[model samples]
Target: MNIAVLIKSVVATDESVTVSGGEIEDTEAKRVINPYDEYGLEEALRWKESFGGTVTVIGAGADRAAEALRTALAMGADEALLIRVDERSVDEHATAKLIASAISQRRFEVAWAGHMSVDNGAGQVAIRVAELLGWPHAGAVVACELTDDGKLLVTRDAEGDSEDWELTLPAMLTAQQGLNEPRYPALAGIMKAKRKPLTELTPELLGVDLAGEEASPRTERLGCETPPARPAGRKLAGTAKEQAAELLGLLRGEAQALKGRG
Candidate 1:
C-alpha cells in the first residue's frame, strides 16, 4: 500500500499572536508541524509499519514548509514532497487544487490529512481534495485499523458521541484529534531521515495557479484589534447571601449598561 499524509507548517502554539496588514505577523516565529497533523502522520507510519508500504508526506506552502515534511520523515515516512509557493495569501480551494494537481498521477491507495489546521481551521482542504479525486472521504477520524483484506475501520469523535466507519481502498481521510499517540522521533529515526528521498516541486509546474484565490467567506475582517483587558475581580468579603446578591447586581448592571441604562 502507498499512503500519503498531508502536513502543514504552523507557528508554535505558545507564540504571542499579533495581526498586521490583515495577516498574522509571523516572520520571526518558529515553525513546526501542526500537532493534529502529526497525529495523522503517526497513523500513516503505523499503517506502513504493519502493512509494509511506503508513506509519502506532502506539504503545500512556502519553502519553509519542508520543515514539517522533514519532521514527518524523521518519524518514518518513506518519501517527502514539498510544493513550494512564494505567496502568503492562499484560500482553501486553491490549496486543495494545488495539492491534488501534484498527486494526480501518483498511485496511492490512501490519502490522509489532519481535520483542520491550527492557524486557519477552515476544515475544507481535505473535502476539496476528495472531491477533486472523485473519492469518498471521512473527516474527524480518531482511530484507524486495517484488516487483512485491506479494509479500513475508522472511528470519529462526535462531541459526546462516537461513530465507527468502514472504508474500502482508494479513500481519502481527515484525521481528527485522539487518533493515536504520536510517536517521538528517536535518534535512529532522525539519522535515517537524513538519507530519505525528498523532492521539491513548484505549483506552476503542476499547471495550477496557487496565487489566485477566488473564494471569499461571508465575513471579512475590517481590522484586527486586541480585546480590552478584563477588569480585576471585585472582593466581596461579606456573608454568602450578600456576595451572591452582589454578583447578581453585577450581572444586571452589565445588562443595563448594554441597554444604555446603567
Candidate 2:
C-alpha cells in the first residue's frame, strides 16, 4: 500500500505573471503547491490512512520545487524525493522522462498526480509516466474505492458524466477537483516536517541526461505578451429589418477580415 504522489511548485494563482526573455518570470512570485495536485495529495493521504502505508511525494524541477515537497511533508506525507534540475526550458516530455526514471527506482502499489498543472495545463505528465512505467492510468478521477478481490475502482469525470474504472495495483490516477478537501499544514505538522526524511537527486545520478536542452526543447516559447484588449460592443441604430441588415454586413466584414488573414 505504499503510495506515491507527484507534487509541483508553482506561482500562486493570485500572483501577477511577468514574461521576460520569452519565458515566464516567476522567480519573484510566491511559490505554493499547485492547487490541482493538492487534490491528489489529499487522496493519497486519505488512502494511506485507510490502508497502512507510507506516502512519498516526488517532484522534479528547479530548487524551489523542494519547497513544495516540504509542504507536502507538513501535510502528512511520510517522506519526499526531489530530482533537482537547473534547466528552465523543460517540456512535458523531458519532465516525464526525468520523473519516470526516478519513479522506476521505487516500489509502490499506486501513484497519483494532478490532471494538469496550472501553468502548463498540458494534462499529459501522468499519462506519459504511466506509459513509461507500463501501468494503466485513469485521468480526472473524482472517486476511488478498493474492491474485495484486491482491485481498485475509480470514477473518472468525462465532461459532465463519469465512468468507473477498475485497475490493478501499481496503477496511476490523476485526481480532479471534488476528490477531497486537502488539509492545511498545522503548526505541529509544520514543526514535524523539519525532521521528515527528504532526498534530493540529480539527473546524472538517475542515468538521465538533461544537458544540451537549449538545442532541442520539445516545446518552444517564442514570446509572451498579453492579448490585445477587446473592443466595446456596438449598438445598431435602426429598425428591426435595418438592424438585421447591419448585423449581416458586420458578420460579412468580419469573415472577409478572417479570409484576408488566412
Candidate 3:
C-alpha cells in the first residue's frame, strides 16, 4: 500500500508575475506546492493513514524546490525525494522523463499528482510517467477509496459528470479540485519535517540521458504579452422592449462580425 505523490513547485497563484526574456521571473516570487498537487498529496496521506503504509513525496526541480518537499513532509508525508533539474532550461518533456526514470527505481503501489501545473498548464507529466512505467492510469480523480479486495474504487470528473473506475495496484491518478481538502501543517508536524528524510538526485543518477539532443527541451517560448485590456461596459437606456431590441441588435451585430472574421 505504499504510495508516491509527484509534487511541483510553482509561483504562488495570487502573486503578481512578470514575463522577462520569454519566462516568468520567479527568482523572488514565493514558491508553493501546486494547488492541485496538494489535493493529491492529501489523498495519499489519507490512504497511508487508513492502510498503514509509507507515503513519499517526489519532485523534479532546482535546488530551491526542496522547500516544497519539506513543506510536504511538514504536512505528514513519511519522506521526500527530489530529482534535481535546471529550472531555466528544463521543459515538461524533460521533466516527465526525469520523473519517470526516478519513479522506475522506487517500489510503490500507487503514484499521485496534479492534473496540470499552474505555471505551464500542461497536464501531461503524470500520464506520461504512467505510460513510461506501463501502468494503468486515471486522471482528474475527484474521489477514491481502497476496497477490501485490494482494488482501488475511483471516481473521476468527465466534463460536468464523473466516471467510476476500479484498478489494481501500481496505478497513477491525478487529483482534481473536488478530491479533498488539504491539511495545513501543525507546529509538531513542522518540527518533525525538519528531521524527516529528504533525498536529492540528478537525472544522470537515474540513468536519464539529459545530455543527448533527444533529452533537450522540445519547445521554447518566444515571449509573453499581456492580454489586451477589456473594453468598458455600457448601460442601455429606454423602455424594456426598446432596450431588448437594441440588445438583440448588438448581439447579432457582434456575432456576425466575429463570424466574418473567422
Candidate 4:
C-alpha cells in the first residue's frame, strides 16, 4: 500500500497568537506539524511498517515549510513533497484544490490528514480533497488500523458516542487525536533524514491554476474585538438562603438568554 499523509505547518501551540492587519504574525514563532497531523503521520508510518510500502508526507505552505516536511522524513516517511504557497492569501478551497491536483498524480492506496488545523482550524481541506478525488472519506477518526484482509478499520466520534466502520482501499481519512501515541524521532533517524528524498513541487507542476476560476468561499472580516471579561463574583457572608436566592437570580437572568427571554 502506498500512503500519502497531508501535513500543515502551523505555529507552535505554546506561542501567544496575535493578529495584525488581518494576518497572523508568526515570523518568529516556532513551526511544527499540526498535532492531529502527527497522529495521521504516525498512523501512516505504522501502515508502512506492516505492509512494506512507501509513506510520503505532503504539505502546502511557505518555502520555510520544508523544515516541517523534513521532520516528517525524520519520523520515518520514505519521501516528502513540499507544495509551497503563501497561505495567508489562499482560501481552504483553493488549497484543497492544489492538494487534490498533486495527489491525483501520485499512486497511493490511501490518504490521511488531520481533522483540522490548529491555527486556522477550518477542517474543510480533507473532505474537499476527498470530494475532488471521488473517493470514500471518513473524518474525525479517533482510531484506525488495518484489518487482517487489508481493509481500513476506522473508529470515529459521533453524536456523543463512538462508531466503527470498515472501509476499502483508496480512501481519505481525517485523523483525530487519541488514535495512537506518536513516536518521537530519535537522533539517528534525524541524521538519516538528511539523505532522504525531498521533492519540491510547484502549483503549476501540480496542475493547480491559482488564478483560474475556482470555487472559493466569500468571507468579509468586518472587525475584530476581544470578548468581554467575566464579571467579578461577590462573596456571600450570609446564610444558605441568601446564597440560594443569589444563585436563582443569576440563573434566571443568564439562562433566560438561551431561550431569547432575557
Per lDDT, the best of the predicted structures is 3
Please say which candidate is ahead in lDDT: 2 or 3. Answer: 3
**Better candidate number, 2 or 4, judged by TM-score:** 2
1 against 3, candidate with superior lDDT? 3
- Candidate 1 C-alpha lDDT tens digits along 146-232: 888978898887776889999887889988888889898889989999999888888778777543443332234466666778988
What's the lDDT for residue 243 in model 3? Answer: 95
Q: 1-262 in candidate 3: lDDT tens per residue?
A: 7899999999898888887766667688888999999999999999888888999999987766799999999999999999888876777787888888888898999999998889889998899889889989999999998888888899999999899999988899999999999999999999999999999999889888876886778888777876778888878999999998888777768645334442
What are the per-residue Cα lDDT tens digits for candidate 4 across 88-116?
65778888888898899989999999989
TM-score of each: 0.87, 0.90, 0.89, 0.87
User: Clashes per prediction?
Assistant: 1, 0, 0, 0
In candidate 2, which residue ranges exceed 4 Å CA deviation? 212-217, 255-262
Q: What is the lDDT of residue 127 in candidate 4?
A: 93
Alpha carbon deviation, residue 182, candidate 1 (Å)? 1.1
TM-score of 3: 0.89
The candidate, 1 or 2, that scores higher on TM-score is 2
Best by TM-score: 2
lDDT comparing candidate 1 with the true structure: 0.82
- Candidate 2: deviation at residue 238, Å? 3.6
Pairs of residues at least 3 apart in sequence or in different chains that clash in candidate 4: none
User: Among all windows of ten consecutive residues in candidate 4, which has the lowest summed lDDT?
Assistant: 215-224
Enumerate residue pairs that collide in model 3: none
